[model samples]
Target: MDLEAFRSLPEWPMILRDSWETNAGWWQAGFTEGSDVEYEEQIKPIVRVGLGGAHRILDLGGGDGQLARVLAADGASTVVLDSSAAQLQTAHHRGSSVVLATGAALPFRDGSFDGVLICLVLEHVVELDEVLAEVARVLEPGGRFLLMLNHPILQTPGSGFIDDVDLGEQYWRLGPYLREDIQMEEVDAQIFVPFVHRPLSRYLNGASARGLMLVRMEEPPPPPGFVARAEEYLQVQEYPRLLVLHFERRP
Candidate 1:
């Protein structure tokens, strides 16, 4: 796969350690201030994960807890956890109950939470299996898990390179989405957090191994801004912005 040069030149990691964590900091500032597209397409739907009741929801990579706050407002008991102090500060400032922590080694006890939401989170974790194990351990029997992600199939390295379609500047011009082997490290300048694009089977099998059952897996349709942005490049017939999943813990 031929990858174009990485953009966001001088690529610096924002105070938020991971992708969503930085986004949470932005969300703390009314979100609409910047990156509203991500906020709309990525964050909002997860907030509706357990819309009706007040289940205890743990926002796994939930930076400033924007989604946690929304869930809390809906009367759900919510806790946002992230590794960055800056992001946690933003989360608290935004009125969310948040913890400064890493997803791989969560601080909560086993079976402590009723539900867990890993929105745009695992992509950044260096230890995906550890994080999934922690998530499974924290959830109670029959609890739910909702995950949001840019689909690996469409985002795979070669998916955008087909000649029949011109992915335009933005789509055609970014990291090659699918490449099994990639390595880089930049701590202070860029987030040291690594990203992986394993197929859906990787996620499903891991969850099953940990005694979690898939209740639902949905490709949430993109929001208006998302649709428009994609249109600028190509007609996006089937790229999922969010993977709304529901999983139940071992009974």
Candidate 2:
């Protein structure tokens, strides 16, 4: 489902900004709540094999800079970049040295960053090619791109977010992994988050063509704490709540 059709009008940056500021805490909670935890435990060990503490990193669409601040605090020369002033302000307030910029048009010289992380953001942008091309241009030779996305197969248009569908094998169901070529519908929410549904393949092929070599692809399972903390159906053992991809620029 490509949601751009449901939107009679486009909310370029303003709506995007408001969506986060209004739910500013949600954005902040991601670091404490989402992949940053997995990144440290599961994703980072795989990613750090080729990179180092001295590497300069660029975090794209880095809303509120939870991971960015962590990376910066970890001795990496980290730059968190986003288009919103308020988000940038929040990131700065949260201890991120953010530059006001959009992913489609990165504000940096070629091959500037050693690695780039586009966490949970590719689903929202209309101009993915532009942003990726920009990422390719800015990443140093052999640079890495780490992307995380909400699984589109299990969650689609019009039909509300399916919490967890049963795979019917273990204690937890590993599903809602129905791959469909469904239509795009942008439902109204408290926040207007424009999303486009793409088969997971689209991301890999796109990155492959853009000079990024696919190094890793893994679906992160829910943490054991997920059941104790919040109740979501099935524990989503297989729904692919997160995808960690490590790609390096082609020399």
TM-score of each: 0.75, 0.76
Q: Write the per-residue lDDT of candidate 1 for residues 26-78, one digit (tens) a residue.
A: 44554532456767665665557444463888998786677777777778899
Query: In candidate 1, which residue ranges exceed 4 Å CA deviation?
Result: 1-35, 41-43, 158-194
Top TM-score hit: 2
lDDT for each residue of candidate 2 in 83-197, tens digit (9 for 90 to 100): 7666777888877889987898998999998889887778776667788889899998977777777655544445343333374333332232333222323333443455555
C-alpha lDDT of residue 37 in model 2: 52
At residue 218, candidate 2 shows an lDDT of 72
lDDT against the true structure, per candidate, is 0.65, 0.66
Candidate 2 Cα errors over 4 Å, as ranges: 1-18, 29-54, 159-189, 230-232
Count of backbone collisions in candidate 2: 0
